[model samples]
Every structure is written in structure tokens, then in C-alpha cells.
Target chain A: MARVVVDVMLKPEILDPQGQAVQRALPRLGFEGISDVRQGKRFELEVDGPVDDAALARIHELAETFLANTVIEDFTVKVEEVAEAAK
Target chain B: MARVVVDVMLKPEILDPQGQAVQRALPRLGFEGISDVRQGKRFELEVDGPVDDAALARIHELAETFLANTVIEDFTVKVEEVAEAAK
Candidate 1:
């Protein structure tokens, strides 16, 4: 199995109302030292496969298609193999 | 000045209750294709500094002291210098 981390955030030009709302709510959450909130989404996915360039490409496609909005958001993909094959 | 990105995540041995709650909420939020949720946090900070080794180290300290729970969380800090002085 392989573990993948994906993060999706608003484009710089987009107005992030949801993030703004989260910011507004933080004062009551006992969090200080933050002047603003730029909220985003994160996903950790576990896939069963031998990780290779092929796995990277397929997951990236899935990320672009379903996990991210190309127009208003950008995403990064991080992958780690959970188990190493015996060498 | 410089920019920093800090990511805080649950320790490998800990149970992520908040992450689990968020995962349960996602399907109700109309997000499909996800069977589990492992949530984490990301922070972007802009600090006024020349961004030398010292700046990097101080930010790492802040990350350890206030931004993360040392016993239950692990953090990584990334710094980007915003400008440079004439040399």
C-alpha cells in the first residue's frame, strides 16, 4: 500500500468566503496569534499498488479531476510507500 | 521579510479523533469516493526578517512551542525569503 497526501487551496485571485468565515470563528476557538484564516482542504489516501511513475500519474489525474478545482484551486500530491519490497 | 509554511500533523501512534470526525462529516457534505479522513493543519506566516539561518531556527522554535503539540504532533517548517538586501 501507498499513502498519498493531497492539499487543495483557493487560487490567489479567488475570494475565499469559506476561509473568511473560518477566520471569523477562530477568536472564540481560543486560537490567538492569527490575524486571518486561509482555509483549505487536505486528503490522505491509501492505495494498494506498487508505487511507480504509473501510480503517480494516475493519482495525479484523480487529483486534478475530482480532488481539485483547476479554475479556483490548486493542489499538491505527496506519496509514500507504506511497505518496501525486499531487495 | 519572509514567508513560512508550517504543517502540523498527528503523531504516527496517536488516534486522530478530529480527523475521524471530519471524515465522517465529509460524506454528509456530499463528498464521495473517500472512505476515511486523516486531517491535519497548515499555517502560512509572514515574518519580518532577513531570513538567515537564525530566522529559520526561530520559526522552527515557534512551531515547536506554540503551533504544535510536541507529544502528539509533528511539524515541518518551510521558509521563503520575500526580498533581499543589496550586497
Candidate 2:
């Protein structure tokens, strides 16, 4: 099996309240020097076959259409190295 | 400035309803061949200075104590390349 990873993040211009909450909490927890924090989603997909260009294209389409809302978010799709157990 | 990425995922044995929902919806959307799906969180942190070993260690502690619930989740922290605009 092949593994595909899709990372979906908000647009740079967008405000991320969830991340902001974490950033605000950091100082109270004694972790400082972090200026910004952005929270996003990561999806790991186990594909049943080889991850060729065609497969990658399809995954990209899935990421764009189903995984992320293009109005406010952007996503990246890439093939990750399969684990030994999955090979 | 430096960018640090923290990825938090559910333990392998834990139930992931969100991932299951996505996996079930894929076939309906005409995307097939994916056998499994796991969903996780990705945090992008912008640090105000260099990301040295000490900084990474602190980030790790922060991740463990504040970002993730250790009982059911696992987290990995890494320094990511900062974008030119962030430099």
C-alpha cells in the first residue's frame, strides 16, 4: 500500500481563532517567544496500490474538492513513504 | 524567525470517527481505492528567533503539556524551513 498525506491550512490572510487561543495560552504556561500559531488539518490516506502520477492527481483533486474549503483554506497533497509493514 | 511544525495524531488503537466519516464519503464522491484514513492536527508555530535544540525541547514540552492529550494522542515536533516572507 502507498500512503498519501494531505495538509490543509487556512489562508495567510485569514484569522485562526483556535490557533490564537493556543498562542495566548502559551505565555501563561511559560512557553514564550512564539509569535504566531496556526492550526490546520492533516489527513493520512492508505491507498491500496501504487502512488503514481495519476494517483497523485486524483488525490490532489480529492484534497481540493473534499478536504479543504477553497474559499478560506489551501491544501497540499503529497505521497509519503510507506511503512515497512505496509510494503 | 523560524517555523516549527507540530503534528498531533490519535493513537493507532484509538477510534477515529472523523476519519471513518471521510473514508465512507470518499466512495460516494467517486474517489476509491483508499483503504484507510486517519485524521490529525497540524500546528504551525512562528518562533521569534532561531530554532535551536533548547527551543525545540521547550516546544516538545509545550506540545506534550498543552497541545495534545497524552492519554489518547501522540505528537511529533520538528523545525520547518521558514518562508522567505517570514525571514
Candidate 3:
């Protein structure tokens, strides 16, 4: 089996209101030294069947098509074999 | 300058209560096809002076030491040159 992890983040120059909101709220949480806060999404997928180059490609396609907004956001794709996971 | 993006994700087997809560709440947001929701953090840092191998090493160590809870989460570090960023 293979495990794929996808991360979606806001573009650098894009204004992040969500992040600004979070940062404004952080003082109440007692989290100091936190100059800023940015929220992002993470997806973890486990492919039970064979996951090779084709599977990787499919995951990338999904990321580009649905999971991310290429204009205001940029994303990265990470894949690993489940068998190699530290136990 | 260099921009570093760091992503932190929960371990596969970890019981993600926050994710489950978000999944249950997503029906209100009209987001279909999303069967699960895992929350993660992303950090974007821009280094202006000189960013070389040594700077990359410092960032990695920060990921290891404080940025992530290594027990329940793992992280990936991606580094890119700001000058080379597609504009």
C-alpha cells in the first residue's frame, strides 16, 4: 500500500484573512511568540492496491483539479510507501 | 531570498478527533466528496540576507525541535528560492 499526503497553502502575496483571524485570536490561547498564524489543509490517503507512478500521477491530478486553488493558493504533494512507515 | 514551506500531518493511526469533528461539520459548508478532514499547520518564511545550506539546516532543526509534535505528527520541509518563484 501507499500513503499520499497533500498540503494546500495560501500564496505568499495573497492576503490571508483566515490567518489574520487566527493570529488575532491566538493571544487568548496563551500562545505567545506567535507573530502570525496561517491555516492550511492536509489530506492523508492510503491506497490499498498497488500504487506506483500511475497512482502518484492520479493523486497529483486530484490536487490540481479539486483540492487546490492555483490562483490564490499553491500546493505540494508528498507520497510514501506504507511499509516503510516507522513503527 | 528563500521561501520555506513546512507541512505537518498527523500519523495515520492516530485518532483524529478534530478531523472527525470537522468532517461532521463540513456538511454545513456544502463541501461534498470530502470524506475526511485533517487539520494541519503550514509555515512560510522568507529569508532575505543569505540563505544557503546552513539556513536549510536551521529550518530543519526547528521542525524537529519545536514546530511539530513528533509523536503524533510528522513533517516535510520544502525550500525554494524567491528569485526563481514563478511570478
Candidate 4:
């Protein structure tokens, strides 16, 4: 099966409260020297057949419509092959 | 500045309710031929300086302690250089 990976991230201008919270907590946890922690979402779709252009376009549409909030977030879709299990 | 990417996903054996919801909704929205949808989280950390081995290990600790639930989810960390703005 082919895996369609979608990465949804907040726009640079958007304020991310969760990220900020993580940043604040990191220092308390002793993970210093870090800044600008932005959190986002990822979706991995296992497609049944070949991953062609048409499939990709549809996935893009899905990303725009359901996966990401275009007004404040940006997303990208990528296709990958699922590896076979070893004996 | 450097960009550190942390991708957190549910384990293969674990059940993903959110992903299944998306898969079910897709057909209703007329996007067919998709199966086994898995959803996850992505964290983008902008480090103030270089992303060396020491920095990476700390990030890994953060992922384990705060970002991912090691029992049910898995996460990976990747570092990239921040792009320079065009003049």
C-alpha cells in the first residue's frame, strides 16, 4: 500500500499557545537553549492502489477542505511506499 | 537558527480513532479509494543556535517525556537549518 503523508502547520504569523506552553515547560524540565516551538498535525493515509497524480490532487483537496484550516495553517502531502515485513 | 522537527505517531498496533473518522468521512465527501488512515502530531522547534548532537539528545528526551507516550505512540526528531530571508 502507498502512504500519503500530510503535514499541517500553523502559519508563521499565527500565535500557537500550545507551542508556547511546551517552550515554557522545556526550560523547567531542563531542556534549555530551545525556542520557537510550533506544534502541528500529521495524517497518514494508506491508499489501496497506485499513487498517481489524480490521487495526489484529491489528497490535496482533502487537505485543504478537512485536514487544514487554510486561513491560519499550511499543509503539505507526500506519498511513500509501505515497506514489506521481514520474516 | 535551526529547525528541529518532531513527528509523533501512534504505534502500528495501536488503534487510531481520529484517523478512522477521517477515512469514514472521506467517502461521504466523495474522495474514495483510501484506507487505513493514521493521524499524528508534528512539532517544529526553532533553536537559537546550532543543532549539534547534544541538542538533539535533549530534544529526544523532550519527545520522550512530554511529546510522545512511548507505550502507545512513537516519535522522531529531525533538524534542519532555517532558511535565510530573501533581500
Query: Which lDDT tens digits does candidate 3 get at residues A14-80?
Result: 8888767755654555433335555677766555455567767766776776668898888888874
Worst 10 residues of 2 chain A by lDDT: A78-87
Against the native chain B, each candidate's TM-score is 0.76, 0.92, 0.78, 0.89
Q: What is the TM-score of chain A in candidate 2?
A: 0.93
Q: Which scores higher on DockQ, 2 or 4?
A: 2
Fraction of native A-B contacts kept, per candidate: 0.13, 0.96, 0.19, 0.97
> In lDDT terms, how accurate is model 4?
0.88
lDDT of 2 by residue, B1-87 (tens): 889999999999999999999999999999999998999999999998778889999999999999999999999998888666555
Per-residue CA lDDT of model 2 for A12-84, tens digit only, reads 9999999999999999999989999999999999998788889999999999999999999999987887666
The local distance difference test score of each candidate is 0.67, 0.93, 0.66, 0.88
lDDT at residue B87 of model 1 (Cα atoms): 27
How many residue pairs clash (N, CA or C atoms closer than 3 angstroms) in each of the candidate models, in the order given? Answer: 0, 0, 0, 0
RMSD of each: 6.0, 2.0, 7.0, 2.9
Model 2, position B26, has a per-residue lDDT of: 99
**Least accurate stretch of 10 residues (summed lDDT) in model 1 chain A?**
A30-39
- Mark the regions of model 2 whose C-alpha exceeds 4 Å error after superposition: A83-86, B83-87
Model 4 Cα lDDT, one tens digit per residue, B1-87: 789899999999999999999999999999889977999999999887667788788889889999999999999898756655541
- For residue B18, model 3's alpha carbon misses the true position, in angstroms, by 5.0
Q: Pick the candidate with the highest lDDT.
A: 2
